[model samples]
Target: MARMISAPVLSQEKRERYDAFRQERTFNAYSVGNDTVMTRIRHKSLDCSPGCAVEATLQLIDGKWKGVILYHLLQGTLRFNAIRKRLPNITQRMLTTQLRELERDGFVLRTVYPEVPPKVEYSLTTRGQTLEPVIMALKAWGDEHTTFGHVPEICADMKGSPTNS
Candidate 1:
């Protein structure tokens, strides 16, 4: 007798509305094996009021590197070292920690393979993919005003390598 809670899947119509009203609330289903136990959608976190959707979001992704990590994963699945290559500035400990947090929060899925080398890959869950528009919006804003250079520059800086002007 064990309980497992997989991510919920929204329908096509609801998916269309996901981006627009995602912040205002949340919903999830609980189950034990194949039997669904319960489901709920509500706004209890913000004193049962609105306007804190953005706050809820920030609580999930508010960190120096989580957003960036999510952005890289958006490209597709990546192995641990590969992710390290992308964000060289992040220490191994920090990267492992963030990845664990993302996995715990249902944003990242980590799969382990039993092999001589023990391969592991990280990808986004359905819930994680829902953040695409938000991540992209942040990228667009940074592109327009940050002048902080793109991924290449960031990677170079992380590696302590010189960049061409």
Candidate 2:
């Protein structure tokens, strides 16, 4: 929906509504003949914490399997097979892809050992541990509003019983 913006709205002898909107928007300052400043909308600052860091965090751990993988990884080191066992719904290819991405993003530490069957374990990095509180809070909120209408097994550990009980 587009409205015909009045000429007064564009004037520097401004209006409260225009000022409020200008303050909220990000713009590029422009100079006209050495005496005026202009603003334009463009991509937000990459250094913005929530815009960048938060997005990076979500990128590393967002999606159906990523959170589940992080949840399992929080329980100390676990091998690839162990993660697979916990997240049975995820396809093998996707699980591998998510782990690789997390590892690349510094959210996970992957260790491999020389063994006949080839053992590889994944655990959280220091940066990854920063997500514990976030993930736990999400877990807490989810437990409070479970679609299952029952406490999750993870919550069961905290209170020593299911939510209903």
lDDT top scorer: 1
Error (Å) of candidate 1 at residue 53 is 1.1
Measured by TM-score, how close is model 2 to the native structure? 0.60
TM-score of each: 0.63, 0.60
Off by over 4 Å in 1: 1-44, 149-165
What are the per-residue Cα lDDT tens digits for candidate 1 across 9-93?
A: 6567756665444443333553444323222233546655566777678878877889999999999999999999887689999
Clashing residue pairs found in predicted model 1: none
lDDT, candidate 2, at 158: 45
The residue-level lDDT of candidate 2 at 159 comes to 49
lDDT of 2 by residue, 1-165 (tens): 898643222446444645654543333332443323344332255465556877655655777878878887888998888888776668899999999988998889999899988889899999988889998998999978877644478556544677555
Per-residue lDDT, model 1, residue 132, is 93
Clashes of each: 0, 0
lDDT at 101 for candidate 2?
85
